[model samples]
Target: MHVSSHHQPLLVALSVAVAVFTAYVALDLAGRQRATAGAARWAWLGAAAVAMGGGIWSMHFIAMLALVTPVPVAYDLTITLVSLALPIVVTGGALALTARDGLAWGRLALGGLVMGGGIVLMHYVGMAAITMDGVVTYDPGLVALSALIAVAAATAALRLAGAIRTRAQRAIGAVTMGAAVIGMHFVGMAAATFTFHEGKAQRWFEASPVEAPVLALQVAGVTGIVLALALTSSALARRSAERKAREVEATLAEERQSSETLLRQSEERLRLAVQATGLGTWDWDMARDAILWSERTYALFGLAPGSAVDYTRFLQAVHPDDRAVVEAAVRTALAPEGDGRLEAEFRALQPDGAVRWLSTQGQTHFESGASATGERRPVRLLGTILDITARRLAEERLRASLQEKEMLLREVHHRVKNNMQAITAILQLEAAQVADEKAREGFAAVGQRIQAMARLHEQLYSAQDLRRIDLGSYFAELGQGLAALHVGQPVCIEAAVEPLVCDLDTAMPLGLIANELVTNSLKHAFPDGRSGTVRIRLFREGDDVVFEVSDDGVGSETGERAKGLGKRLIEALAQQVQAQLDINRAGGYRSLFRMPGTRFTAPDAAVAPTETVG
Candidate 1:
């Protein structure tokens, strides 16, 4: 066996790698002890042992190949086996840490002793297998030191496993193992130097062997540092994994408790809901003639406590007139075409001769086995019963009130329309005799305003609800009526009305306003055979209802329409409706008003629109 000095570095590097890997295996095992339990930790320890054993074998082969001495194949094989056993012993100790009943102090001590003895025996046996072709030397001190190093490695591993505490303690344990590895490496190197070469033997520890001690020192130092670093890395990894496991377990526990609490709350809510509704639960067996009911159910039937009420008793409670119907419902429920549960509404006759209606519904549950009679035991039916008498009475009252209100409203609208027509005729007849044109005009305006108000009620009566009217249609109708009222040079009135509906509060004021605007447009807008157009538009803007009326006619007469009753009325009406009115003479004449919501009432000095000849 021969090798260049370059090969020596390679061999030393390989040995250091193996030493680091071995420390990592020990560190990982120690860290996992606190994190994993049961079979997992044991399985991990075994797997780590197998990995470290492979590393050990690799280190041994590399070292054998780099040896300057020609070592026999048998010797190399024996050395490989001895190196492999060290990791296997460390793994067994790690597995023992996870045992349900941990290894006692005596057992740990005994195991360590056995492992140390085996290492010593293997070392001596492998040493015997070695044959140095030209050197034969044996040093008792070197053998003793090597045995001490092996014992020290075994002791460090056992001590670590026995009392591994915090991550820091595990790190210390790894350092201890690395130190033991370093010690064994140098001790073996010193022992190798004692081998005779060309009838001469050298003692490396004599402090005079520079190459051997320095190389050995370098290898031991490097291997120890690498092993320590590897141990720290593995320990940190295991500590992090353990912390994560604990956090996850805590989260899962909290989630489980939260879910349980939610489920309980839901169940309590359901129970309270059932109680508040005055509903009683019942269960019935169709075959065995068995019936079960909650206390509420018994109270519903006007029965005292401890009273037994089977299907027969249940049937007896039904009124004679409704008995056939109740029976038919049960028959339908039990039939093949229907589910084995009855949902029926029927009258129950109490002992006091009072009749009460009950709504019963339930579902059926089939038995697992047949009865002695070779038939399945009667399926059970479970359900709830609720008293719906109050609901039925309220519905009846609502229906009757709706019909009565409809009839009364229609009659009221008809009578009001007839009276308004009578007033209009009376005013027309009276106006015919009026000699003054102003008085006649006043009476005509009065009748038209009255008609405008009448149209709102008229619209309501015809509408589905006598409470609201379509403002657009109501305004348009009033405008048309005003145009028809004017005789000379009929005004060309245009109503641009939006489709809007409001309750009476909004409709009445709008209708009257349209009447005044239209009357003014016709009376003064077109005069002396000159026809002009009057435009009235109404629409909703956001929350405000706007009405605009424009007339292309003669300007306002001083002290005439502008300062007359009509202008006063317009102002008063706008104030009553909480509306703002803007009068513009920019383009002939234009009046605009906007109101919020639908609260309108008649106002004082509510002037009618004044008439002016163009």
Candidate 2:
């Protein structure tokens, strides 16, 4: 009846593999059925029962395969009961979960207790199914071990279910439960081990009746100690986890409160700042044409604090002339033609019968299409407005001041020009009285300088405004004056000039140099009163102003240094104006000057002047 060691390894290996596979299939089927949402709890329980039944059958078949010798008739019946009872206990455990009938706590407890009893019964049945030497034997130790395992499994499941709150915790609970069940099962199986005599035979009726009680007591003591420790540890672990969860929840709630408090304080500060600055806030409902304005905005409009305002009502407050412009600006702000910000300044009629200018500036904040519910409507117009009445008045005063100053400047320049004219006339009379050749020559130079100053007055008086004078018109007049003074009838000095502008600083020096050059050209070039054109061209080139005077009368092939007093006068005047002077005597007498226009900054010389003398 003894089994050889050689067969033992193969039998044990096969038994372990089959047992593991059976456990896997049962758990897998139960898990899949339980995961189906909206499915009846009883349906899943029934499926788990079928799966466990299959597992029990597999376990039995595997144990049977390990049999090298046949079992006794009584032992065979006991083993069958143990195998059947194992699946029944597991099925009852699952059923306990489904039979709540709205009395959850009580039903779960009853289910666990019943399942534990089934496990104990199965253990005793399995112990009774063992035979050696043609004798049947029962083990009390196995029954106690099975009872301990059953109680541990049921308690662990209940603790796990209660401990988990979230899905993640529930998943961990399931894994922990599986591990705990496996561990308990193995512990119980280990405790069930006993040595049997293969060489002896015993009578079934009186075989070891006293020994059974002694063994059962020892087995019960061991099981009781182990079960107490397991329960104590499970309770401690669950309590610790719950305490940690409560701490985490408190910390989160405190953080949320702090954030809300900070947001409220920030909003209050913003409100105060807007109020202090007299800034008016408004919101427009595009669909309803409704407008909501802050209290400060109502004050700005000189309306009562609780005035009824909408798009049409707001527009009515605007001045009639400015209404269309303000409306157009609002339309542009909501749907702008370009990316630039929208701004408009318009006069508004206040409730107190005062007309005040107001400037508004803002950009659009687009609405989300999904948020189309009451009070959750999106914000569109986000902008501010300021009462600019004072600023507009100040600007008007500044403009008036500027106009008065310009008029005074023109009068001053006009008086200065008249004084120079008087001085020139005096110098001309003094030159008429001089008799000495050298004295008269010196007097003529003095007279020319006085005349140069006099010419400025003449041009200033003739000009519409005295801020600036046209360089072209001034030069042409100088040329004509010189021709009339020196070159008479037949020579017929003609000026071909282009328009240019010069301020007072530039006009003075340039006028003197022009007079000297034109006089020299008339006296020297038109020797026999030759009819020819004298061209005076003034144009801008980069940052410089070019002034050139050319004549077509006399050929200037003779190379000689220009020693005439007028020629020296021209060079000195050109130098005084900070201009480059070039006198070319090729083909005809020509003089060119290039001057920096920075010193002659434009005042009111926007359009070039057009004047011709032919």
Give the Cα lDDT of each candidate: 0.64, 0.60
Candidate 1 on 326-384: residue-level lDDT in tens?
89987776554455777888777777887777888876665545567554444667899
lDDT of 2 by residue, 1-614 (tens): 42321123444444444334333333433443343435544454555454444343333333433334332322454575566657555654645464333336666666666655555555445545555445333345754665666666555454443343454654555555444444444444444433435645654532333332243334333433433343344345446656777899899889989989999999899999988888898877666766788888888789998888887888888999999899888766665333425699999898888998998887766554535452233346657888999999999999799768766766766787678667767777887797777786566656666676666766776677666676656665666666555534455444444455566777787777666655556656767656766666777779987877777767467733267676677788888878898878878888889988675555454544444454
- Alpha carbon RMSD to native, model 2: 12.8
Q: Estimate each model's TM-score.
A: 0.45, 0.57
lDDT, residue 327, model 1: 90
Kindly report which residue stretches of model 2 are placed more than 4 angstroms away from their true locations once superposed: 1-249, 268-276, 367-379, 414-502, 555-568, 600-612
- TM-score of decoy 2: 0.57
Query: Which candidate achieves the best TM-score against the true structure?
Result: 2
C-alpha RMSD for every candidate: 17.0, 12.8
Q: List the residue pairs that clash in candidate 1.
A: 1-70, 287-378, 524-612, 566-608, 569-606, 569-607
